[model samples]
Target: MNLYLNLPSYGTIPVVNSKNQTPNSNVLTQITSTTSPFITKANGNITIRQSFWQPVPNVIRYTYKYLGNNQFQRLHTDPHSNLITNSNFPDTVFSNSVTYSGRLIGLILESPHEEEYHSILTSMIPIAPAQSQNATGGVIDREIEKLLEIFSLQQVAIPKTFQTDEIIHIVILNPIPYQTSLFHIHQRALKGTYCTLRNNVWKCIWNIPNVRSDFHSVLNRFSSNDILINCCTSQLQPILHTWLQNLPHTSAPHLLKGHHPSTLKMKGRWYQTIN
Candidate 1:
């Protein structure tokens, strides 16, 4: 998985230790003295160069935390290994680097197969408030505003203290496709799901067993004009429904329209209404 965080402004961000102290030039010495190998910094605007993969045990849990309001807030926890084959499998190697000019940002990598975690802490970085601007908008600003609008329409809560300048855009590539094993099972249990044309749009519905069962079939039928509004369960319904309603509409290729048999069962039956 790849994670990208875009910060609005650029300046020098410091790297500090768990005690919030700046390490001497001998960072390796500091790491050797620590009990656990947790990274101290992974600034989104800076490039970090550190190898996170090395010869180690297979089963390990990696946690990432960021300093917020003088406290470390947990951001992500990844417990994975080659032994597991699910979509959330951890990356084998990781590296992170950021440039001062806000370009050439590298990946933040962590692996249990390695001996230590290296990070740069941003808690000590002094960020200056952005200068006032006119009502005229920039492309990125407009996009952020649009996202805020969509979140509002969907009734998604916004942080009370959130400010436009403080907004950090994080885009995760290939997020775990499903929420849980049970949700995956529900998708697989669907049956009698078919797509049909209605008013120049494609509509689909899937019938699934009300009870849990291992029996399932692969679902490969779909079309570019097909919209999958109704074929999701309560777990996925809100997200899919809201995106379809608010985001730009597009027609997917027929080849990409097929459903994964494992995704068929959700909230009893699945409905897809295309527009």
Candidate 2:
């Protein structure tokens, strides 16, 4: 009896003895007399069957079917239950396997194998470069300015003394009721050390020790508030100043009025007022 293992579109291979010769009488007898329900089809189709005479134990069988010219489909079957389990390939592998043959051919394994396959394939994927923090912060600052403009909020000029490496104090005058949103935006943009609400105003202290070398000259020329004011329209400045004076305790020692620049000198160098 001649036996053949056929691979679709790849032709067939004749089943022979261990020595690459024709099957002897003993091998033929074993093949014929065996009660095992072996493969019944001679075509490329895989037909798995059970047999008591088989030596191998607990071995799950997998069938690779050629769908067309080069495309193929895989089927996995459990050994003990003989039921077909998951048949679909992983997302990454199936996507890349379109143009490349033999990529996912022999990758079909039993249960608990998906994780291992994903781990191996993850290492093969290319990694993208990360964005610089300064660039990200700059974008966030612009967003805050846009939000302020949308809400008709005043843009204050940052004090020159507060631009240094030391702890810098900022005063937000007539802070809108949406103080939380502003606080979150500032935190995200500057990553400030600390911020708080006092007398319905927003006061924050930012301690930036490691200033970027590229921004050193720019920082010396303009404070953070100055940059923010430059981004705003000229029409909003006077309205913002008027709102500051109307705030509670506008004449208080800690509170700096927007109209007067002389009162600001009384505060220490770290203290900076924003209207």
Candidate 3:
């Protein structure tokens, strides 16, 4: 698993440790003596990297194809009976067919755990549906405005508190792109010549990855223009859903989309319709 963080503007830094927690007298002195290494320094520019697998809906899109019947099956005298015959059990031929698996896209972004309150409150209000809201007009404009306020504030605070110009940004990627990357599962099946020769029938399964390495390549970076708060598809809007749904009901939030991960589970927030 990989954790990628992008710092939008990270000029270098002369970093010092905040303070020591509980520690023995000798250990405390030793830790303080250790020098803090300085890596890359930016003026406010940082790249982003890191990855985490979220159990997202619609992880894949699937389609299947059918292959025509085998020649032996067509020629068999007893059509319903087994295809294997004394002379051709080993010689049976078959055509290969395939079906496409699914594809998933993920994003990585950063938020201040502290200032997350206002957006948390606002996001609960929910988005209007695509048709009703007609996001190109005023309604969409208002939502985006609110979101930018929250995220921009967080961006500004990061450098001031950390004494570094860099801050973390989101990095999204699919860790396992194909079924061949999955682990294997084995099971018993009715005995056939090939089955008799083998211990068991084995199948492969792919579980989501804990993290992917591609997230690291873009660490600590984002474009100032790209960091809009209330924008529809990019960073803030999706994250608001993720965070609000995770919060407690004392928050009393509403949602804009019935399809949001939280709303699907039946929660208290108002459902926003995205027009």
Candidate 4:
């Protein structure tokens, strides 16, 4: 399905991962010798994993300066038509991955930077095997994800320009209905396993309902994943951080707004995107 018939330079369509490969391999390779005389052999480049287990990043967070707000904020969807009632919320305010991830630089390796919703929804979803056939669903998965994000933006985070918080207009939800629902739907989109594996298992797997990354990130805004507890989370932050940095970047950034205290101490480019 990674066919390149159509050019993707000018954003004609979402660029896709056409390569038929997955990172499921639990591998440990050691370079003992080098055949090329021009190249020097390096042993530290190879990773030494104790096991093949890939970390299932703890994306959900429960920490919050405040919780659900039914007060001055509007939690309901668009009344007349769909539109964001409040534009000053932190997702649009702070301009990074939101304020929740400020202290997670240490745990980032164990838990990826972007939530599951952010990962799948921002990018064009791969066509499901059944959907590709068009014998079943009408809409594609990516559209479903995008629409869900737009739909839930107001539920957890109040859309009103002015809100209940003494500090800010946004509200943080303890349990993100939007994110949980999406995780239930598309957690295994890129790589999943059913009870049975057929010849086309790899081709068509990630067929689930959708949600946006931002909405879910808000859900996790006040979550417990923020505290920096290296004694508890693990000491392997460096390797995991390296792995995450290597993940492919979407061509266009959503210009996500995130502002937090600790992020100031870190280095390198600061990318803020909704996805």
Candidate 5:
């Protein structure tokens, strides 16, 4: 039997080892151990079944169909479907479409008598990518400014070598409550993760972690994972300032905040205030 596996550029697929293969004959015999990679044959043709271990990024429910071998000709039929409502989504806002395929194999590797049987089951699923949209142009401006600084010489100390394989895209999400999330999102974008920030919303392929101790420590108290941390509007400013002050160097936080016209320091560098 031929086994086929496919995934998106960002996803990974795992193949099962052949230790579980069993033979056709023996009326009642231990074909193979669960942990074992090799299977034993009982009679002539044995049918083995298996399932995928994990769900892909945007996979929802999937349908599997396949063809069966017959005396005269091969018979095709619809077998079953696997539903993934139990699988966890990284965030409440994200959705996606993903599909995976599984099949039985006949390879004995070292066994001289190994035979293969093809399955009649295949799967297809559709899922939505996590998404969010901002209605406020003011929010969009905040987003554009952030992007500018992201690409700015002062903000990006390291030079980015251009590569055709790199995918660069920007998307703005509404309801950004904490600066910690912004810190992570920015780091991820630099590393090739597409992310966008607007006045109130935020979205991305994945939340990148903040390497900066100031931001990382705060997030660690709540969640170590890169999900958005929602904060009340009333607490936004104070929390942001607190986090900014905790950064390794006072200048970094100030620069992040001072990007706004109203927040720009007047006379000297803003780092003096922290000293």
Candidate 6:
């Protein structure tokens, strides 16, 4: 099931640990320190010599490819799925289709675990389908303003305090373009495969590197602007119906047109952040 939320301008919410626990800073710290001796950092930027595959999300969180039959079936993502998964099953993934498993790197744009919020109460009031469907980017902002006027609503919550409590920069290594990068997933790649084997399957499943030794730096670091959110298509009527019955204003959130991963051009070093 998809857990990430994509918001315009504000940026989409990255995947969070279950129950919204903060991602462990210690884990990132340890990995970087242990590997620092081998990495050369200049001007706080670690340069890259070789390109690497970064994990990104497909629609939903699984990577897939359609067989010649055009049927979405489990195609093998890599030859070593049997190894890292330690099962005869074909779904376990150790790394993306391009490299061995390692946590994504995000440089410290903001400190991790610096503080925590009890909750964020964002009430998404719904609008007519025609009006909602027409909204995107800045247009959505204007629609919200209109809704606020109609409803006499001013803010999402009281005692307003905004905190950019999340975000860190991982020195994204030599990242290839968005079209051919690795995807982020847990059980499988989202939707169907990339329609091609190399685009869908892990190219270096058996040749994953030791973080301390194998990482190659990039000439520059990736910024939040380089991050792109990915989504896929699914019939959401059931969930939308449920939300209309249970959520605020007797309505569910609006959705944009969802295209398959094969059609998306989400940029490199793609990783989601929790909002």
Ranking by TM-score: 5, 4, 3, 1, 2, 6
Per-residue lDDT of candidate 5, residues 231-263 (tens digit): 112223344445434645321311222221112
TM-scores for every candidate against the unseen true structure: 0.17, 0.17, 0.18, 0.18, 0.20, 0.16
Candidate 3 structure quality by residue, lDDT tens digits, 158-241 = 112211222221112111221110011111221333222111101111111122222122211222222212222232245434
Q: Positional deviation of 167 in candidate 5, in angstroms? A: 2.8
- Model 1 CA deviation exceeding 4 Å by range: 1-223, 226-233, 250-275
What is the Cα-based TM-score of model 2? 0.17
lDDT of 4 by residue, 1-275 (tens): 11111111211121122354422222111111322121122343321111211122222211122223323222332245322222112121212354532222111211111132223322322111111212111121112223223313442232222222322222211111211111222223322331111112211211111212432343233333221211111222332233333434432111112211123221121112112
TM-score of 3: 0.18
Question: How close to the true structure is residue 242 of candidate 3, measured as C-alpha lDDT?
Answer: 60
State the lDDT of candidate 6 residue by residue for 23-44, as single tens digits: 2343223323433222233452
Candidate 2 lDDT tens digits, 27-79: 33434443333334335322222221111111112233334332334434324
Report lDDT (CA) for all predictions: 0.21, 0.23, 0.21, 0.22, 0.22, 0.22
| Candidate 1 local Cα displacement, residue 22, angstroms | 28
Q: What C-alpha lDDT, on a 0 to 100 scale, does residue 113 get in candidate 4?
A: 13
Candidate RMSDs in Å, in order, are 25.3, 34.5, 25.9, 18.8, 25.4, 23.6
Top-lDDT candidate index: 2
Better of 2 and 5 by lDDT: 2
Q: What is the Cα-based lDDT of residue 255 in candidate 5? A: 22
Any runs in candidate 4 off by more than 4 Å, and if so which?
A: 1-53, 63-158, 162-255, 259-261, 264-275
Q: Which regions of candidate 5 deviate over 4 angstroms? A: 1-165, 169-238, 244-255, 258-275
Q: Of 1 and 5, which scores higher on lDDT?
A: 5
Better of 3 and 6 by TM-score: 3
